[model samples]
Target: MEDIPQKHEVINWKLEQLLVFLQYCNYKESMKGPLFYAKILLFGEYGIIKDSKGLAIPFNSYKGALKSVKTLTGEAKKSNSSLIGLYDYLAKLDTELVDFDLKSFKSDIDNGMYFDSSIPQGYGVGSSGALVASIYDKYAINKITVLENLTRDKLLKLKEIFSIMESYFHGKSSGLDPLNSYLSLPILINSKENIEATGIPSQKEGKGAVFLLDSEQIGETEPMVSIFMNKMKNEGFRKMLSEEFSIHTDACIEDFLQGNMKSLFGNVKKLSKVVLKNFKPMIPSAFHKVWENGIQTNDYYLKLCGSGGGGYILGFTEDFEKAKNSLKDYKLELVYRF
Candidate 1:
């Protein structure tokens, strides 16, 4: 007797059929896999790129899941069409190191199968990362299992693969976002290339609250990063980033890890000021006054929750009611109450 093919296997079979059609017409692969929603580093943006300690978590507000459908609707079809070009490129690349059931993968993609996710693009969340992780999980042969022991070496290997996978969206990727998605854990670290999962300080009563303030605009990360890179070329900017930004960022990370609430907020105050002075362009024009107001009044502190420009602005408030009152005109999404 033979075992029945599982639902996923059935879907894979359908995908293979579609791939044949696409290959016949010379269409390329597009999506790596379905991805879930990811939250941005409300405080760490350019700071993280410089190896300043950063923190990010999964945002459940929006999520995406992969499933093969007989038909796609609206944006789904359009997204799938765009992916064809990407898949074509991947097919031509040296994918010997990565594991992918390319034959079936191509078929599903060709048959109009697309990743159906609600995670918004260009908000600095790991939208592409989640998709990359999903693809690796579904198709990679001898893949790393989330259930198995994840040693540092395995984690590093996973990051390398994900970085390659996610490069399709961003011209370059650090692999941190997808790595976080793959592990679904709060990742803490000393540097980009050096990272690990660690425990976070729990919120305490009467402590500050970490929240998200929606900028109501979409932020394109590639451009923002480009700007930051150009700025890095300046000797003065580099000095300020290393001397001021890195100092504050490192202090905040250490204090948070040590569970020193007072020290964390103090360092966060400095971090907030530094971001306001250096990252003026990333903040939406409408929020400029508020950004300054928070720094001056200390009613609330604003940080780059993700890549800045738009989406959600990470806010830290000692008093939620006070912070709300201060920014009564804008919308606020509570993330964590510390």
Candidate 2:
């Protein structure tokens, strides 16, 4: 087993973080800086890759912020090292849409800057996306600010820029994750080219809810995505993805946005069933039984949260209490209430 940090070591680390925060305030940048929140793809996970509709929203429960310390150790030290690679990638990037203050960024990284983030890596809640957003927010020159009117053209431009920037982390990225984290708003993807800021129905004080089921394992995006791509090569898989997966995914997005609960659940059930039947590799093996149990019992419906070999599995249920009882063995985190 990995050795845990001693209590005193933890305290010293916290003190170093506090000192760095004070130094950060003394700098010309905005105080405390801006936090880049993790994002959740509420609908259209795999579907979005093929130009199907997608809806992603900021998940404030987990977020990342850029922090600096004169000296770094442990996790922060590791994060700083990773940032160096990202910096190297960005420094050589030749893009007209976006450019970074590579000198200042490198200076900070050399002086012990790291992402102090609560978001868990490989959980599909956009840990790398948050990191990418934070880097762009801090270093990008003449970057588009969220304050400005986000025209369709501008949104697509941002997505394109983010796509290239974030490709360093994931071999191929849709860029939707970083884009959603950067804007910190609900993003609706009509297709690859048509994306816009969208509004979701406000949460209501009802029993029906959306929740995250902890799979107690981290999921690697690249491998799972490779599996998806390999599967796409099969004509039958392509047909099912377009005809069945995309259709139900699109309906779920629309129904969710419009707050058509009855229609939404109905479509979600179908979507869940389709995912179970088709995307078995994407769903964690341990979860297959429960995934089916939800569908069979109507207690809750399970769907992939991101690539989903493991990590948090998205669940929807008419009764949160019943779902909780049904899923008593696993950890549940509430995301949205109906």
Candidate 3:
């Protein structure tokens, strides 16, 4: 008789835990859900692969969401077909490590499912990342939500999971893109082992700004990555990466985070030069002169936005209107202001 209340208390505690678990389960559909956005690797680029620090920020100008439709048609059908392929992949993934509610996912596919997205593919922004985030959100069982009490272990675990999931698109993935899009927050990669969500200096509506220059052509990441991998074979390239590439990239990250704008531009210029001289094949020929012109004139500085083969060229300028006037021929979208 004495143990009855104790057992009742234990049962009540478990019920409470079960209620919390149920709340987390319905957190997405019932309340605020996810709308994953594109991500911009503002710094590091290829250098991150060489163990350099990287900074990534969410680009909300484009985003993707998972939705249900009455019928699949047009591009939705094509996208649905692609998702079916993903379904096959996820079904085979190890359940102990990362499991999804595949039954529901398959049913959704059968009932006309598609990822309606505005994210441009192979444009250096995270198109596949948005898809990975969406899939994880809808299907991943016992998934870690950004809202949970987050620890470094949990963060790393999430990144590991995302890497495997995103690898379906890119032959290999750092998991940074999906992580950035999942959190929709600026992420600072101190190193591969040390990464955390970080806050950047608040935007000031001033003449100085960061912007994206449209290359107007698709940049395939896999081949660009392959090129980088091939370049890794050269000792000179490795030396340049260690001494110049990583140096400029790390300095630029420090300068940007510290809001040392004057110094930031100098480091950015050095980075632009390094990328131009070393990463020539990655940059389109048409923009090479202009990329150099910016370095010469100081109107703006250009650097690779992603893997660089083609997509968006990241730019920084002391004066936006002046930069705009100088770059009138090309499409420039402002990303950040200072």
Candidate 4:
């Protein structure tokens, strides 16, 4: 990390965020302004790419943003280093559509600017997506505004731009993560060709819930994705993916959107079984038993949150308290109540 800048002059917060920043603590706004939250692919983990339905929502608990710190330290310094690499990557992208203000980006880095993130890297959550969104917000020229009346074509264009920007991190990317984080809204993906901002049923005071079971280990997306790609080559696997996997997944999406909780739970149980049986490699060895136990006991059903080699496992239950008591030994974090 030689020649790394140690000092920086912070910029004023964006006009829209300044009022809130003044009332809240330093954590509320980035030096450059608003942060992007992490996102969870509530449904459609791998099936989405295979032309299945998907739903993604912002996970406000973890967030990241571009910052100009007086003294870089620890995670901030590491993030700055990564952004410098990103700068080099963007500088070489030979495209008119994805152009950025590279000169300002370089200057900002030289002035000790770094991405300060609370979002955990390699957690199937949108950590790098948040970084990419933050960079585009600060440096992209003629960037699309979230406030615009987003048309289908415009949304696809944004996803394309984000795919190019974020491909540097993942060898290949679909860009849904960044799109979800940038919009900070639930996105309903009918398929690769159809996507739009969507409204989901609001949370209710009920015992039923959807929660995340932390794996406590980082899972690299590249390798997990590669494994999936390789598996897709088998004809039997493709059959199962379509007949069993996508069938259940599509049903879950339909039921959830229609607010059919009774049917949603049933579809989720089947989806969980399909995932556990066929996507075995993605589930961590430690969680395999408990994942199955939840299904058998009807306490809860666990499914892959994202790529799933070792990230948070998404769980659904008709009764949260019952599910919590059933698996008392492990940690669980609630994401939604129904």
Candidate 5:
């Protein structure tokens, strides 16, 4: 729509190819969709669940694409089989309220069309959200033009659709993942209903680096969330979140946004401590000592890169060399500089 080829061209070419193939096969119309990389929440997790400000940025290391195939194989077959139930559920929804070319959609599924993505599932990287966004973009009828001036109401509607679509993966969805996928911009999630693209502060010249420490284990969001929900049932957990978690989380967001690096690290120290104290269950048993040592020794501060448990741990260090020396046992991926 903006005379740009990179984004629209790929989607359009794929759609045309599918349609031509359909015509040759005596099938229905063709639709196109864009794929996106997964995102990592640099900050805010359980804290955001309580309505504290959260920030997420696209992590291009992992990505997903939508393409129609005549057959599936191995894990792809199983994944497709699992998603059929979800597609069927969506088809049964009120037709007038939501539009989709169900026949072609189902046909693709029957023909073994599956999403081929590198984004690790349950790593808090928005893998399922990318799939959902791709489906809606390709098949939804009278789809909202993404190029149009997107209003608050439009954003809400999109979130609702994404929530339904992503439910197949997470059992429950905050809808932030798919929202970030569709927009391909950094999203600031203020509340479940209040989210928007926000500009991240520029990096500074310093010896420190903000990095992701891969736990080398896949983290299942559902199980991790289940664990948190159970923890929340305890009054002490709730009190801790209300008092320490929220305060530190809010301060961290404000400080980062204002480019107050010193203040941000200070708050991050508190956040790292709170996370270590309260989220012991979510942290890997093997990493417990390391997590505690980082906080107690002030060598580095570890926070949730996404949903914790496993995947990657967000880290802040005043001295990269010192932190690296201290965390030599674990693999670390640098994401930003300070």
Candidate 6:
């Protein structure tokens, strides 16, 4: 026989092994969880608010997922702390349209659960939208699964639910961001009430491209939106948005969807011009000349990727090489090619 305390020592070792196994399980589950990707609103930035067409596509460059941790630290700790606020907000939500498993959500949060994400916040790339998608995916009871046939009614229902949920982050939300991230598909907004899944032309080997120009700064949606609301009070600005802005935006969407690069460039240039002339406050002052130069020269056309106080500026060009050469000083990320 062994020492008198050998039995207790064996029990301790077994308990340690069990703890490791549980941790391994948690890690496995986290790894297997679905990743909600960031979304890019290619068209209909401010115009969508006033019932204009919009097109959004899932951008896999940045993504987020629900994860469990043995000990939350660093970004994970910060994320966990922030989730408490969301949990409180969700727990008190009075919506009869959907219900979340608050008990399980709270228990997970208490056990050091956090969203593992690389999507930058306040960048207009749907950072909070992805987080909201992750939570709804995991904790919502009778949640709408992506596998089902997403009829127009179902799509609207999901958007409604997401709008209410995401409103906690932004003062007001259209719900398009979270819906795009959640569905992982290109979404076309015909208007505020009519939205449907859409398919864009497959990427091709060509010179023309769509890219993101990094402003190297974060953008807050609330303030930018407030600025837009204040501008809407002016009759002239409202007419410009409805007549010039919306017209160009709708044409761009149509051209893009139809793969008519020739028409797309023409309309995108017009849209870029309108944005520069009117939405001056939305554009970062540093890039004011950069925006104008793109319009002056046919090298490229730049527009807002989101609300655009300071985030990524979307660019379109017939020849990316030329646009790259012209904007050589700035960091450019290619999003699409045609």
RMSD of each: 9.9, 8.7, 11.0, 9.5, 8.2, 8.0
lDDT of 3 at 259: 97
Candidate 6 residue lDDT tens string, 144-204: 9999999999999999999999999897999999999999999999987899999999999
List the lowest-lDDT window of 10 residues for candidate 6.
25-34
Which lDDT tens digits does candidate 1 get at residues 206-246? 64787888888999878888888999999999999999998
Compose the digit string of candidate 5's lDDT tens values, residues 1-338: 58657888899999999998879665322222366778878777877767777788877777776655566788778767766876887877763446788888888788777777888775667888888878887788888767987777777778777877777777877777887788877777777677777888777778877888888988888888888889989999999998999889888887877888889889999998898888987888888888788888888998876667788778898888899999998898787778
Q: Which ten residues in a row have the lowest lDDT in candidate 3?
A: 25-34
TM-score per candidate, in order? 0.84, 0.91, 0.89, 0.91, 0.84, 0.91
In candidate 1 the C-alpha lDDT for residue 139 amounts to 70
Top of the candidates by lDDT: 6
Q: How many backbone clashes does candidate 5 have?
A: 1
Off by over 4 Å in 1: 1-35, 204-207
Residue-wise lDDT of candidate 3 within 1-338, one digit each (tens)? Answer: 36456788999999999999999877555333368999999998988787789999999999988866777889889899989999998888774668888999999899888888889888899999889988897788899998997677777788888999988888889998999999898999888888888989999999999999999989999999999999999999999999999999999989999999999999999999999999999999999999999999999999999898889999999999999999999999999998
Clashing pairs in 4: none
lDDT of 2 at 211: 97
After aligning candidate 6 to the native by TM-score, how far in Å is the CA of 285 from where it should be? 0.2
Candidate 3 backbone collisions, by pair? none
Model 5 misplaced regions, further than 4 Å: 1-33, 94-97, 204-206
Worst 10 residues of 1 by lDDT: 26-35
lDDT of candidate 5 at residue 273, scale 0 to 100 = 88
Question: In candidate 3, which residue ranges exceed 4 Å CA deviation?
Answer: 1-33
